[model samples]
Target: MTTSSLEPSEIDLTDWDFWARPLSERREAFRALRQLPRPAFFREPEQSIMPTGPGYYALVRHADIVEASRRPQDFCSGKGAINITDMPPDLNEYFGSMINMDDPRHAKIRRIVSRAFSPRMIQRFEDQVQAVADQIIEEITAKGSGDFVADVAARLPLKIICDMMGIPESGYKTVFDNSNIILGGGDAEFLPENDEEYALKLLQAGQTLKDLVEELGRHRRENPSDDLVSALVTANIDGESLTDQELGSFFILLVVAGNETTRNAIAHGLKLFTVHPDQRELLLADFEARLPGAVEEIVRYASPVIWMRRTATRDTELNGQEFKAGDKLLLYYWSGNRDESVFTDPDKFDITRDPNPHIGFGGPGPHFCLGAHLARREIGVMFRELFRHVPGIRSTAPPDRLLSSFINGIKRLPYEL
Candidate 1:
């Protein structure tokens, strides 16, 4: 298995140049990578237009991605932003979520929310998930034809996570828009009506999150409950309680991370079914028994979170290629899932593909997607209901991909529910 370096000539701007194109165009680029002999990561060369002031490399191969994600010690997730650029210092100071933090602190924050995500808790939530999914499906079915993205996929995950996080149902629009705009503001089209307006939107979103955290913090203090916010407020590690900053950071994380990505996966999964009717048929046939594979395949294919970055702690050799310290590594999980070396018939969508080890959920390791099990449950149950209730569902209009490449999901999926 020989892996060749990407030549300067081969480095067309469109070679994984997701940031510069429309979602439709970007999906074409992803389709093209499927044909590449080996997985390739996108990077702005030092002389190229995009700057790497923060500094890192993009890991595009299946094996290298697995390595980079698993061994956080050597390739830490804390040095810089998970996306292509760094978050402003003040923004990071306020909204620094758990995914970016390294161990000890990362471990501590993870522990606070861990109880809510425990297997027992998750299993208990199955009925809630099913009920929510069923209700959403019923509404979709009643319409007979509706936008899957807006009517079904968008509402389910956001509502579930909002309920779990103790967020008022009314705050969802603010939370959803804020999450998308903040993470995806880089996309020129996805920016608010205007750049100046978009900036204001971002500020308001951050403030809303701040207010939410402070209010929830107070609620948790006065009358603790089993909800994640209260659990987090009450959690203690080595006699160290989560500070206001930490709690605020995690509250944003839980809301954003819990909602957006799952919503994307559900939306994208429905889109994939429209593309792969056979897989859809198979899933509909044996949904109860085969739902697990369908969920895994959805994560593998859509990979809503397209890439995660890691700054090299020191020089490292990945796939026999040496990367220097301070090099920014962008692990393209989307490309990895389609790697021919790891998956058979890589380009073909196979919901039943067994032994699937795609890193759609952050590969297999400690940082391997803490909310994965819950995500799976949500997707699986939704699909089961979708296939059963909205049997005739299909996309009525083309998808509008999120403007930002960081969170790769459909911004608008016009469809018949």
Candidate 2:
């Protein structure tokens, strides 16, 4: 299919209305886009906060996203990876952490911070994750039924991240609210009504998170603990440590990305199981043996992060398509996860799906998710507890989906015990 052949009215990735459609329609639209000869170009979505750029190629295929991720020198992320529009200079300090940085700088930060997220560190917290999951399940059982997102799914990641950072329980709600605002920019429930107030609100949210972490970082420097904040503040890898601003930005990235992505994955997991009972039964039959595959399938099927942006540093060709320097491309991870060429019957949620090379965390690269192991542990433990305790739990109604092109978020998912 040619660009002209597919009208914008029929399918426009940039349109907010397109994202607001039912999940099935959006999946079908992407299925059609994948069959195109080359990635289709669409005008950037208009925003009151930032000026629209020329346009961006939607990298819908798995191969294209993987290639782009591998060749970061050509399709760089330094400009911006989270947003299609260029992030303003002022916002970069808060929003532009290693995810938005190119090599050398990105490598440096990742190297220092990598120690905290290493497998050993994650394993040390394994019992903590299980404990938290048990507590959450107990609460849900006591409450009987409610919004799963709040009572169950959202609590685990939020508490885990906050505990890792040495944040007090008093600040948990603050972190949760600010992170939602940061990621839920397109949602009216979390954002202001006025268009002009959008940027200001975002800045405020970032500042709130930045201040919270900076204060903890300072305290950690004076009185260190076994928490991630303590490790980061004093981490000296070849005479390099995270600066206050860097610490703040990294915290924002960690809390928002870590909490939001894992939360959504769990939320989507319940709904997926509710819809596909056979998969749930298959999982429950032998959860210990099947859970590892189940976690991978959950991330694959319900790609929490919808897409990430990349800009061409110089002229490049990917998958036989030519592109000029400075051109923008949005790597639609959601589409890549569902590529028919990559996974057999990709739409079907099979817990025992072997060779599942899903890019839900992201395509393989320096920018791949650092907290992936921890996320898997959280989801696995949470579900293990749910299946053991609330054996008959399922979604009572369809998820109240978040209206955003970026995050496949479920604001509220009603459930019963």
Candidate 3:
């Protein structure tokens, strides 16, 4: 239900080339959208299509996104959380997990999973994170140079999350390979020849993940251990526990959403350090004092997961624009994090920037990232390890970014340590 508000020529969100552009160009496009008074309607292109149930409104402003996320009752997520598309309810259930849920079910699953991250567990994960960061750096530096994504960035979170899930070392590559393809959008390296092949490829990857979780869930249920899967399988909230499907779905979410994001952020952190060496020096000068803020700044700047979707439950108006029941909206965190009204010199990557108010972890809402605490620790530890050990490390070439509007990921980053 687009109105006079939309200026179609301004941009096309559905274009593949748009997503493949350099970071600067992409940010500029989003920055331009922020000036509009209302969210713009986007029509998903037909040729390179997705199963987007309804057209989506691009919510680019900080205020609008914050409002939509806060008012989850108005803008729901039960249909699906990916902007511009909606998966079938059953598929969304398995893949989207609690992220695609609303209210009772969302709360129920979150409560059970939340228990897995008790303070003691977070402390333990933090200790293990530091160890993994040191090990990754030790391994990478030993090679003198390596692809930062595989050698360094991807390893820490992959190791930590797999360790937490009790996934054996033999299966690390399986998890890693599947996740990359799942989130790769339509990148040729990951995606196949056509839509039919792509669907099969995605299904194969997804099935592999599900099989792993089911196998692990069965083992953990009988031989319960201190791992997250065991905690989840045995968890009880209000006399209800996660069903095998729910447990498997949640595990899928943790592996894909959990590992993919932090991995990209750490990769981006290294690239950012090389690009803005002064920012690196600021952190290097007083690693302890600046580390926390640096992590926030990096997340704000990188915004690993770009946008999340919300479906309108009923007719509503935001920023003076009318939205009908069932209208889909995308909360573009990347744009909101860079909104000029909120951030002073928003383009500048300032490690000392306080009152950040970034939506890197989604905005203040029920759906904020569950692994944010652990992610921050991982990013902080990795940088601490990098600066301390590989003092002269720098990216030798521009990153080969994954062709994804959804995930702000670097597929390959060449570096010299």
Candidate 4:
């Protein structure tokens, strides 16, 4: 419990080493991170004020991330949501989502969503996912080759979420476009610029999702169906149902969560396979047995949900380092995934990495990712179909990483499907 045993000055938040290099050069960065004198998570990278105007400390060590994630009380979620953009202060209360709440409120919202992603709820989607995967692969295979990002990863998740919400086929593109605008707003291909233009684009995206949620809520209210929107419309929480604002925020969470993360996971998963072709062939050869491990490896390698933010509720010591009340902490899950202390040969994509404790979907805590099962199901199915039908689903062009340091990932992976 000696506080400065691990000096705060030793950490480097801007870790340009791994982040600066292209994808092909990232392994060296991970290797270098492994050789650092102390635990990388405990390393203090440069601190900067966020666009939202809050100051935060970024945590990179595996143990520290696990501790922060598990201790949601002293470290609260309300510090901010996963993104850095400022939520208009006046509208903050309404945007109070499960991802942005602490303790009881966070648990409450999670329970409501759990209803939609429970064992029974998720089971219903298995056949649907396989079917969609089959049809899409059939088209891609016939064409012989195409950009996997466009031909596959970007297509399936929205369709699945829309089906779950009973949304019409036409709404898929709008939902997809809006998520890209909000989540990848800083990515040049997605939104182009990071000035006021990007902020305006995010507001526009929020308005679109807000409008869709309102209309969907109204429809479900009038003529209830077996879809999630309908189920939520009639859902009672502590004998009280979701109000319009609650309904809107929850719906936005579902659609955004259901789509973006899964898409990134799949796209990034495929890229990992391309980089580690040996592992790719190994999974394809014994797919049924190796597929689950392959999924874990991809999640570990990609770490799609790069980081999640927390606010310090009280003056405390994390890993024996002092932090003041109201200080922001950015828990870098990406670094945790590659922690050498946890995995032998952490940089290599081994489909056989047993005891894979990667924090891709996050770990034990109040805000652990709820959509993990669905993500695994979706990514597993997509890879299965890609290997089976696409023959050689490897990248044909160099992949482009999204510009935003948050939720960092590939923007375009031009693969020959």
TM-score of each: 0.87, 0.96, 0.96, 0.88
What is residue 211's positional error in candidate 4, in angstroms?
Answer: 0.7
Off by over 4 Å in 1: 1-55, 88-90, 116-120, 188-200
User: Could you give candidate 4's per-residue lDDT for residues 205-282 as a string of tens digits?
Assistant: 777877887798898899988888888778776876667777777666767776877888898888778878888889
Q: Write the per-residue lDDT of candidate 3 for residues 204-260, one digit (tens) a residue.
A: 888899899889999988999888888888888889998988977887888998799
Q: Per-residue lDDT of 1-417 in model 2, one digit per residue for the tens?
A: 233354434788888778887777788889888988878899986777788899999999999999999999999989899988887754764696988888888899999999666566677777799999989988999999999999999999999999989999999999999999999847899887576788789889999999999999999999999889999999888898999989999999999999999999999999999999999999999989999999999999999999999999999899899999999999999999999999999989999998999999999888999889889999999999999999899999989999899899999999999
Candidate 2's C-alpha runs over 4 A off are 1-9, 118-120
Ranking by TM-score: 2, 3, 4, 1
Order by lDDT, highest first: 2, 3, 4, 1
In model 4, the clashing pairs are 11-43, 11-44, 12-44, 12-45, 13-45, 41-60, 41-61
lDDT of 1: 0.72
Query: Candidates' lDDT values, in order?
Result: 0.72, 0.90, 0.86, 0.73
Q: How far is candidate 2 from the true structure (C-alpha RMSD, Å)?
A: 2.3
RMSD of each candidate? 4.3, 2.3, 3.2, 4.9
Q: For model 2, give the 10-residue run with minimal summed lDDT.
A: 1-10
lDDT, residue 229, candidate 2: 96
